[model samples]
Every structure is written in C-alpha cells, then in structure tokens.
Target: MIVNQFLVLGALLFSIGVYGVLVRRNAVLVLLSIELMLAAVNINLVAFGAFVDDAAAAGQVFALFVITVAAAEVGIGLAIVVLIFRNRSSANVDELDLMKW
Candidate 1:
C-alpha cells in the first residue's frame, strides 16, 4: 500500500476525532474522541516509519509509547468523569464547574 493512503486515512480519522471532540457534550465521548485522534497519530507514525525503512523501528516504538500514554489518559479521564458524574449526576462537559472557585 502507498504511504499516501495511510496519510489520507490518518487525516480523515483525525478530522472526525476533532469534530467529535468539538461537538460532543458528553465527557466520555470527548475522551473517546481524544483516543480516536491518538489512533490517527499512531497510524501516521507507523506509515512514516515504514516509508523511512528505519532499522530501529522508531515509529512503532513511538506508537507504542503513545498507546501507553493514551491508556493512562483514559484511565485517569474516565476516573474523573465517573467522579464528576457521581457528584453531579451528569456527564455533560458544559456542566462541569469543578475548577471554578
């Protein structure tokens, strides 16, 4: 497959993710959108790594790191979302004011 194909796919996924993040009101949906964006980035990384023919497989390694960080993000994000829902009974991002003094 051509690298351009992967690039286009990545761009499409990233665009969708961005739209979801911007339009979705639910915190869970926002987190999922963020994950989608990360997946697009991973796709691009692997594609570029293959195109470069790097011996170190740096692209795959970086993709792995991104995955790890994403997992941690999801864990923490969900935890906070759950806590907010428990306290507020709503998961709407617009309704959250925990940071407000």
Candidate 2:
C-alpha cells in the first residue's frame, strides 16, 4: 500500500483519460474521458490525504466536493449532448458548430 503506487496508478489513469479526450470524436466518449480524469484526481487526493494524516480529512472532503461537481457536470454535459444529437443526428465533436454565427 505504498503511496507511490497510488500516485502511479493515478498518473496512468489521467494519461489515458487525456489521450481519450484528445483522440475521441464522440461527445459521449469525451465526457467519459473527463470522468476518468476526475476519478484519477480523486485517487490522488485520497492517497495524499492518507499520507498527510490530516485530522480534518481535507483530502477526502475535497474529493467528495469534486465528485459532487463531476456529477453535476455529467448531468449538464449529457443534456447538452443529447440536445445536440437530437438536432444534428450526430455526436461528433468536430461537426458541432452551434456556437458559430
């Protein structure tokens, strides 16, 4: 249960998430990648919190806050994606031009 092991695992997960975000063309896949990245962050936070031996459990608390925010983000993101898909019939990120005038 070495802290380094946890750190390495988090780093690996984050790297994979980044790759997925950069290479994937689907909006849903992008959101999944973002969730993966958030999970990696949570892993690191808990690992550090345990390592620091903080009395207030700040790391876990912050991780909880991140989880809450991530959930909200997924809700909003999926809603937007669904709307776009319904309108455009495709969820490809590169094809989206809703912001263009």
Candidate 3:
C-alpha cells in the first residue's frame, strides 16, 4: 500500500514537472522543472529500496549519483543561463534558441 502510494505520488510529481517544462519558456523555470522531475525519480528509487529490499541499496546509490549529477548540472546550467541573459538580455529559452555553435 505504501509503495503504491509512493509510486503514485512520484508519478504525479514527474507529470507536473513535464507540464511545467512544456508550458514555461524561461530558461531558469525549465531547469527547475527538470530538477523536479529528477527529484521524483529519486523519491521513487529511495522508497522502493527501503520498502522492498533491505540488503541491496542499488536504488539509493543510484539516487545519490543522480543527486550528484544534478548538482553539477545546476551549476553549469545556471552559468549558461546567466551568460545567455548577459548576451541577449532575455532568459526565455524559446527566444534564445539561436543554435549556438
């Protein structure tokens, strides 16, 4: 029962994140939505690892790696967003899609 609830909530969070990414145009907003989706995946991983397997911690380990990567991604992504704003004076992803080489 608890697993099912956790799974449902995770799915809902992921769906919300997808919706936000699709509807929002700001670069920072889209990045935050992506982070939300990643968080939902981590939640499901930890919940299942805790409830189903007490010995193997693969899910938890994966979540940790994901968190680590997400942190790196946020740093680089924010720096890029700031660079874009400095160059274009706008942070909207749609407007900034000039395909930089």
lDDT of each residue in 1-101, candidate 2, tens digit only: 57999999999999999999999999999999999999999999999999999799999999999999999999999999999999999999999765887
List runs of model 3 lying over 4 Å from the truth.
97-101
Candidate 2 residue spans exceeding 4 A from truth: 97-101
TM-score of 2: 0.93
User: Number of clashes in model 3?
Assistant: 0
lDDT of 1 by residue, 3-34 (tens): 99999999999999999999999999999999
lDDT (Cα, tens digit) per residue for candidate 3, span 15-90: 9999999999999999999999999999999988888786769889989999999999999999999999999999
| Candidate 2 pairs with clashing backbones | none
lDDT of 2: 0.97
lDDT of 3 at 64: 98
What are the lDDT scores of the predictions, listed in order?
A: 0.96, 0.97, 0.93
| lDDT of the structure predicted as candidate 3 | 0.93
